[model samples]
Target: MISMHKIFRRLIVFSILLQLLIACPLQAFAESEEAIFAGGCFWCLEHDLEKLDGVVSAESGYSGGDLINPTYQDHSGHQEVVKVVFDSDIISYKDLLKQYWVNIDPFDNNGQFCDRGYSYKPVIFTSNQEQKRDAKESQETISVGLNIPLEQLKVDIVESKVFWLAENYHQDFAVKNPLKYNFYRSSCGRDNRLKKVWGEYKY
Candidate 1:
């Protein structure tokens, strides 16, 4: 089981950010805000983030690859990413980063959930110096809460780039193909493994 101290710390971090958002919900995104992450199944992240109130849209795609416009079959080397678009008015990028931090094991620096490959590695793509700083600082927060060394986590914080959305079928795979999505999620050992790693913060 994960340590109670850590869960308490993360909860503190999450609550602090949410309080900031709730205080300033109308501070909308200055532009077409974007945040991309590669954490195992895009379908899972897509489904989860889409449920948030301020999230305008979320698309599954491939990033940090040599090839552009990659497909699921063609994503042999690229990490599957979820491109999230949100309105700043309803929430803040800092809060989004907080949620992202809670969702995966950043320490592995490899694949997330059941996947074990560079293609499934977790990363954050930021748009500016502010985001760069925020992502880095947030990584530190996660590292402290999880008792993971900074260098061991090895999370990448790169500049944001264009994202070519995955095929339509992958857009809403979880909803369109619930059974298959559930099977993929289960087979990946994501929930089970996460439960083992994170029982108290099993949200």
Candidate 2:
């Protein structure tokens, strides 16, 4: 009879454990995700964002162009962009925006680094209206809080209609050809100029 009591207690405990497990909401766990930017060559930002702890993937692409299907040659009018997939749990959107700001020359309205023209210029293609608001608000904060003056040109925070992946050859161009990537980056002078403008800024 005493042994029966122990069995009852064990059964009750097991039932409670099973109930507890069932009670756990099935909502998907927070996972890392994507955030994109087209500040310049995808290679430039790709390398920087990939260094973060939770970033899963970074691919360069084309966005905000009028062309229906833009290719490298046809991408003439399109901006060079990067699509970064990361673990959202590990890195917040605000942090990603901060990382974006650190890379581009907010003061220069033209293409970032050494690259010139609208195609290489800075633009934050937002995933949603909330992100749009956040991007604008962030820029305003950076202007006042960050030491580097805004180039006085309007920062384009456009809604992305579609993000077309770049050709296979362009994917991870930096990783595939380290020498070429390094040479392109250096010649563009993106790093030196960015450091000069933002290295001292608090943002």
Candidate 3:
């Protein structure tokens, strides 16, 4: 039979182990971060960013405008954006910024590809100073690499505003309606434009 002292010691060890296990996951969760970007067609942007390994989720949303409870039909000032949750341990924000650049037509201030309007315009909404700094630096890098002037790189890097989640039907539309999503993407000339703007370098 086990002694009382042995049982007490075992319980102590077990409690410490449980605490450690709980703390580890909490620590890892703390590393999770959010990033917001608008590159036209929230469905496309949401689908594109979610393909990255470290990204936990990419949800379609509307942001960068004063509109409250914005929806798909009438989001006048708001731009269609993707809110990306990623594990910083696996992928840094700088890496994400690089990926964003190649996927967009930086010269198009009016909108991206076939989607023309204020809602379809490209933007990088930085939530903090670090993100803002990284975004501006990435913009500069893209300008130099593409041989375009800073003013010509139309992708705006600005402060992030309230990101209202889009309607449930809009979220994960690509995964839900693969055929329709593929047809729309192809017809919209998104990939073709990306290829022309970025050559063979895109994510």
Candidate 4:
């Protein structure tokens, strides 16, 4: 038979475990997935993607560039990108792709809206083979659905590389600087072109 001291120790352990379970909910530790998208203006992309149901966080960054630790002013070849962290149980990767396409100008090879540069072109950076396959399929579906040739679509699917997070101020520019963000976005004609390309549908 166990001694009284042993029973007391077990009870203590159980109490500690109960406290841990209560303090940290299971959903707090739920597994999360990540997707990277390079669209024009990381501020706009971050704001749009984070508004999605399953998206837990969206961080503005730069990717697909030769520079190391690229900054907003220094990211010459880097594309303005957003890293989306989401819960897979709430939204699938396919759903993310579907939403991503509607947010940008899929046909513009030059740049997006008023942003003119290599850094402004949209891209999907896949983290794995499955992601690459899904991205390609999504691109194909868009091409076929629009009755446009696959070759004509400007969006490219590239394997993901290092993602350098932009400065903290740039992370949530839309929310932090709403007036300026709105002015810039409106003057850039981003929404107008998106409506023209996507036709009455909001992403």
Tell me each candidate's TM-score.
0.78, 0.79, 0.87, 0.91
Candidate models: Cα lDDT each: 0.80, 0.80, 0.91, 0.91
- Candidates 1 and 4: which is better by TM-score? 4
Q: For every model in order, what is the number of clashing pairs?
A: 4, 5, 0, 0
Q: Rank the candidates by TM-score, best first.
A: 4, 3, 2, 1
Q: lDDT value for candidate 1?
A: 0.80
Q: What is the lDDT of residue 65 in candidate 2?
A: 80
What lDDT score goes with residue 198 in model 1? Answer: 55
Tens-place lDDT digits, model 3, residues 1-203: 99999999999999998998887866464679999999999999999899998998899999999989988887879999999999999899999998888888888979899999999999999999999999999988887887778999998889999999999999899999999999999999999999998896533
Cα deviation of 195, candidate 4, in Å: 0.4
Each prediction's RMSD over C-alphas, in Å, is 16.1, 6.4, 3.5, 2.1
Q: Which scores better on lDDT, 1 or 3?
A: 3
Stretches of candidate 2 off by over 4 Å are 1-30, 147-154
- lDDT preference between candidates 3 and 4, better one: 3
Error of 4 at 86 (Å): 0.9
lDDT of 1 at 140: 81
Give the lowest summed-lDDT range of ten residues in model 1.
24-33
lDDT of 4 by residue, 87-165 (tens): 8999899999998999899988688999988999999999999999999999888887887899988998999989999
lDDT of 1 by residue, 1-203 (tens): 98999999999999998888888644452455778987778898888787787888889998887787688888765788999998877768888887776666766667887778888888898878988998998878767766768787767888776677899998978899999999998888777776675567522
